[model samples]
Target: YTLMSFLFKLMEEGYELDLTYVTERIIAVSFPQDCFEETYLRNLRDVTRMLKSKHTDNYLVINLSERKQELTKMNPKTLDTGWPDFHAPPLDKICSICKAIENWLNADPLHVVVIHCRVRRNLKPPSQQHV
Candidate 1:
């Protein structure tokens, strides 16, 4: 498994591969690490294919990372968001995240929600170090 796979396992059984199923209509995936134009586009294509197969049609992506600006510049289609690394999100952000998820899930039974964030290693500080 790649380092990214080690960080987030496929939560459900079946053909999802690297993607994790949080629910039948909700999936989780690692943020594609390659930001370079060519590779990132390829990665986006692959991810889009997988999501299409799973959701069949409608889907909403909720990205939870501080890298939103970079990602937005790369792909204008996505709705970008930010949450600080290694710390819990502030109450307002938490409510907004939950609200978004709830809204999407309630909008349609077949609508799939995909959430992405950087891997655990990037999300938290080294355990061996002291602040």
Candidate 2:
């Protein structure tokens, strides 16, 4: 949710976005425990669905692990570079993230959604953490 909010804010500000950097920042800030929560997953699905419905042409959904691998293979100096035209005919397909979002959107209308737990595996006690 924090990451999504950041991306949404960046988009609204008309910035030339670097998704790789954005994703990295998000992952860096996220607690591992958050990954297991139902609400966190649902929120992710909701945000993805919204992004897909609104930005179909601009979005690219790849597995997070795969994306990280690809990033590692690139030269550090070229980390800011984006693939605007790397064509492989068979590689054009809807990604799993987008598919999950579509499934959620198709299943029911979304409203009254709330996530109330620490969405991280490494959540320290509240006294030890700062947002």
Candidate 3:
């Protein structure tokens, strides 16, 4: 697929806020509706509030999507992996991801870590696994 098509696919239809608690301190969520879009700033604001409500202000983010654009500095401190959708990071990146998370979690009991990707819930359906 062309780069443009891939980007279009990333914007899933019926986009809504869905948060999955992968662990007590780790939450999973979908990308925030093409966050850079000016029209979606309201939605981004809502998302920011929702996220902050789930944890203390001392939270970090692990963004697995290659898209590094954020909510105009309104988001919590984030770590962009520069990893793309529908694929795993290399072994070295995996190791660093783990280390970063571990360090953040260990730093404070209230330090929540939010994880996200381009697709829904950072996962592809079984049918799309091999695409």
Q: Which stretches of candidate 2 lie over 4 Å from their true place?
A: 1-36, 66-131
RMSD of each: 7.0, 16.8, 10.0
| Model 1 C-alpha lDDT per residue in residues 9-46, reported as the tens digit of each score | 33321222246777787778664443355544445455
Pairs in steric clash, model 1 = none
Error of 3 at 58 (Å): 1.7
Backbone Cα, N, C clashes tallied per candidate: 0, 6, 0
Comparison by lDDT, 1 against 3, better one: 3
Q: Whole-model Cα lDDT per candidate? A: 0.61, 0.34, 0.66
The lDDT, on a scale of 0 to 1, for candidate 1 is 0.61
How well does candidate 1 score on lDDT at residue 42? 49
Q: How far is candidate 1 from the true structure (C-alpha RMSD, Å)?
A: 7.0
Q: What does candidate 2's lDDT look like per residue over 10-29, in tens digits?
A: 46754332333333212111
lDDT (Cα, tens digit) per residue for candidate 3, span 1-131: 34234334335543354556688788876654444465345444655666676564877878776766654266748888866544568999989989999999999998888786554355565677798
User: Top TM-score: which candidate number?
Assistant: 3
Q: Say which prediction, candidate 1 or candidate 3, comes out ahead on TM-score.
A: 3
Better of 2 and 3 by lDDT: 3
